[model samples]
Target chain A: MSVQDDLETVEWDVSEDAHITVDNEQCITCEDKPCLHLCPAECFDYQEDQEGGIYFAYEPCVECGACMVFCANDPDKGAVSWSKAEGGKGVEFDFG
Target chain B: MTDVAFDVVVVGAGRAGVAAAYKLADEGFEVALVERAKQPGMKNVTGGVLYGSILDDLVPEFPEEAPLERHVVEHNIKLLHGDAEVSIGYRDLELREEPNYTLILGKFDRWFVDRAVEKGVTFLSETTVQDVTQEESRAVVHTDRENGDIACDAVIGADGVNTTVGRKTGIQRTMRNEDMALSVKKVIDVGRKTIDQRFNLDSDEGAAYIYTGFPQGAATIGYFIYTFDEYISVGAVGGLETLRWLGDEGYGETGTPLYSLLEDFMELDNVRPYVQGDAVEEYQGILVPEHSYDTLPDRHDRRVALVGDAAGLVLNKGYTFRGLDYGIKSGLVAAEAVMECAEDGDWDAFGRRYDTSLEDSYVLQDMKQHRHLPKFLKNERMYDAYPGIATETLRRMYSAETDASGLTWRQAYRAFRRSDAGVLDLLKDGYRGLRSL
Candidate 1:
């Protein structure tokens, strides 16, 4: 098959389980959400909670460990923790 | 029916296969080189850098006739975080001379294949080897698109990472997904003047850059800007597992998400200028075999021998991107082993000789030496903490404020500490990085 045809016919699937997590209760009123800036996939979404606190969405995480590595020393608030989702349960790429 | 046979049959017409055929033919062995592609390079993929030293050994004065893009004059390594970037790089004029390192080879596979053909090696294109018809002594090859079988004394499987010959011969059972790297690249057309001025290069020099840090995740992303006459070959490579992980998290996996990531990077007020207005002429993706030394299959089995990615010889460390050279070198070594076996009239000892020679050569030594690099690169901190901390540190160092007293370097250290990476962790990472080299 032609390269273009082969690429068009390929399919991609994503898993439902989230690999990145954030503890909402411990967060402080930090002005900048560092996780948002460091994420390679830009997976995190920062929004105001009902109590005027920052809420995060951890979907679309590439699991490159940027958040956890950068947030390890935060004394006031725990930013993020990362782990492998599950074996044989993540993304599948036909082109790659 | 006519009976046609050779002393050696080299499959796949790629860098490895062509090199093997050329070397064997040069040593007075009748060689038949088979290729499945419409042309030698039509189905081939490469990063387009022909590490000059490797080619010079194979064919002297190669730079004179080789389709080289430009001699690399600059090398840039960047740690990127959000809109901030921390870069350390070098430029050298020594690489621009006669034995220059050129960013070339859009059609390198074909070029090598032609050289092999010129050296009395038979070229059979548009033909695929379906299977090997083995006898007690010799083997005959069956082609899918050809009418007759071609028998040979030995067969070399240089068919790349997904080698059917290697699979059929049971030399390699399968290649694991983690053992591969997924890369997306594009040949971009920007005016020569634009490329030279933007990258701080003259018309004859090329530049390559690698970025590791948050923007690339724990996964390493390398961008190369090889100067062609009026275009630049730019791209990124990351672990296949990392790409899949991102895809599983609901980001599209067919390169659109990665393209979006690149867009986000370029949109950053700092990075937008370098790639602005460059038209992407071609976009392609390839799988780089990144299996550790433990994953490498046996070099030989009876009449069959594996070379190149089929043998799992790809090195992705920081110093070099070296699969093609490995392919060429291994191909030559395999041919030499076969020549020795031919001289001895001992077909059974061919496999052992090939393996021992490979172990003795730099091909195996390099892989064995850097076997830990893949795991080290896979460390999350390499992608996560370092980029952000470095970029933030650069920002603090570079920014100018008019009214207030400047913050002390101690404050800068505090900012780095505030980023959550400690001195001990940095030292550990440094040791691991050093060990990888």
Candidate 2:
């Protein structure tokens, strides 16, 4: 099955509100946008129609903290800001 | 500082926090375990096993008390080169009963906290700690709730890898992609009967299979397949930097995304039958320490201590990954230090005692021994070149049946050894690996 097909069975408790924010300027500097490949949820993608050319959909986020650490801590990188959803309204692991 | 209401406060109600609370409560200390989740373990990503000998000291009758799924008796490490694989497995009947177990952390954490609560430990659920700072000799645990702030003589940061307490309190620095990993796991319901029959488990026994060699571009990636009572835990872990190298294009032409890797792994020829009819029950992801021994901060700092992921007590040697056992051990060590600090009324010495306590324990000692593992493992050759060479060598040796030309065993092995790195390079790598691991 495809990733989207497998995701149909996976459950997520999305915060509704995105707990992560990305800076347009910061994202453009790293055209690679490494977070797109590293994110397990595939919550990020390129949007040719958007202002920043990067689109982020947080609902599918598992709150893995990968994007946050990868972007925030890089010596020359600062594009993504991440924080846990309040009251733990994030991905609630059913088997995790 | 003198207004500390509780003797000690532990953050995150997962394995480390619960273990710390239980130990502190047994020492007659008023301990409060705070968690962001609705309940202990509810937010935890389940799967994986608790390895090493640390569990025995934490719980004497661990097998009976712990919420374990299966006792893993077989371990197989596979080097997947193309569609071929080379594996080494070991199984022992006696070791299958106790000490090591495959766990569903969501269930285990809850069971662990229940045990702690029964030991006079107070559990505060739905409380997310905003910051952890020191005030004189006390710790102020600020929460999101307006009036939910708490003060304790000592605080234990038992939160996971994305540790707010450790990072905010300056006990530890922010994690970098190089030192972290994005690990994804999926729980597949394959039926207990099918699992038993396919894995050849003699009731309650399980297997742990770790694989590498994901194309040449994504060679640094590793995948794991573990057996549970009625489920199979399949997952993949890649170094953040290495994973980033794949970009969105995915490990070459395959265009594999992070989640798709699990699906691909489950569909492998060798794995297809075991999970043929099974369904994906759960899929989750989390950030993990990438085995840099420095991932762990100083055991304690004045009125505060760090344990588990917050403390970064992880020993991931790639082949034999670990966190659970080390998490429990760190909690026990931190708890012992807290008990001593309360007994002596000297919080400053808490840090020293904690370091000393862990220094002698297997957690720190084992970590120290393998301190060079990360550097050694980061070699790109390990991912692509080695797996290819190993698999080819085995293929050549095993092809003696089809060879009428009469190729010697030594010639067969030598044929593939030259395929990748030469003898000198292999010798250097072998020496480095031996010393590091």
Candidate 3:
């Protein structure tokens, strides 16, 4: 493998269930959403879906739990659940 | 079993293992160093600050050949409260001269391993040590994914924080939840010009910043910015217990996860400007043992010895982030003990000597000295009240208000005492700080 290719495969085996999931219904319509503002991986996204409701995706999540800690509304209580992804899955950084 | 014994066998060719192998080989001892990774540093992760004193000790004139990033010239501490920030910092040209602290170590493990190989230490890469078969006189290290068992008089386990050798030999217990700090880091590819300008550093000079207080809260959160050749490494670390505490308390509004906290920290108006044109090249998360004096495990068994993170020797004070240095130093000490035992022909005496050396060394002393500091940092007021007070006080002092308000510095201080802390609480905290330090 090329040096770059070899570097690309230095994957960390994250659990399959290791990710942060958010319940859109529980999102409070606040002027400033701290979760959207604070995530290091830019995992949280806000957009108008086809039906006009705000759509959110956390595909790039690193599972650091900053949103759950800073969430003004209680997300961990009911709105969001954070858990380790299935073993050998999640974002793998080659250069880190 | 065929007789293929070496004077010493060091497992896991990370910083600690490499250092020990180098020292022993240089001292004319037959050493066999084994690594499970494809290369020396393939499985290693470091915050990437090569502290000057340790490097100077290992190789007195190291700068000429070391893969150094930049000589650090500035150090900053930021206390964040909501949207406001209180910063205390120092910049000196002296730190950029000879014996200067350098932001290096991307290829440090490989370089160190090469040095050991040069000194006649056999480098065995892509070899995994399955278990140690202990006999009365010597230990035979069994290997899978490799050919045969290699016997050695003594073994040194430097296999980072999540050590398999330490666990298999029962030299130390598995790390508890509170004893480990989960850290995530990223290398953002901001060009050299952008990095120099954004961090206010000159050519070949770098800056480092540490943050505490709001956003990070009572948790031990530290963000470091180190200059690479063409990128900047930004990273944060927090205790797992504190992370669990925050999760239970229900904090984020939009359901921010712990790993994403770094993004939030970087996106802050205060931090965003530095990386305006940068692109993230990598992101990684690793566990760091907090090196609490209480959590230190006994160093030796009948034939095995634990060194580096296996013995729980990571030090993370607010001002200094040192792990590689401790790892190297402990490995050197362990090697010396093993060498002493080889001379005396007493394995039991060797094990005792290793433990005694650790207790007498500066590594153990430093950990014991700062034993109480970690608990003091866990205090919520230090993150919440102190940062809020300091920031508000600075704001009032610097405010360009035309209105002639009769607020003296003392009165301004009292107004900023809007924190939940009272005089007695402050006094008790003061005492704790003094005692801990």
Best by TM-score: 2
Off by over 4 Å in 1: A1-96, B1-3, B97-106, B214-216, B247-271, B401-413, B422-424
lDDT of each residue in B138-220, candidate 1, tens digit only: 87877755465788888898877666677667777544446666555556678899888988887878877666663546565
Residue B370, model 1: Cα distance from true site in angstroms: 1.4
Cα miss at B164, model 2 (Å)? 0.4
State the C-alpha RMSD over the true interface residues for candidate 1, after superposing those residues. Answer: 13.7
- Model 3 DockQ class: incorrect
Docking class of 1: incorrect
Show the lowest summed lDDT stretch of 10 residues, model 2 chain B: B247-256
Q: Considering chain A alone, what is the TM-score of candidate 2?
A: 0.84
- For model 2, residues B215-262, the per-residue Cα lDDT tens digits are 453645788888988988888887787766664474222234666666
> Which of the two candidates, 2 or 3, achieves a greater DockQ against the reference?
2
What TM-score should be assigned to candidate 2?
0.93
* lDDT tens per residue, model 3, B1-437: 63467878888887778888888898888899977665666556667466656657767756777666788777788888888888889898877674454443437667778878998999887666767756788877765533458888888888767665776787776455466776777677888888777887776887777877647365686676677767887777777545544533223332324455666777889877865543556665566787568767666776777788777788877766767778878898988897888787897666678888988988888888888877787788888887777766666667776333556676456654687777887898889888777
Error of 2 at B180 (Å): 0.7
Cα lDDT of model 2 by residue, A1-96, tens digit: 655665676655666677788776776666566666677777777777854567888787777788878777775768888777676566667678
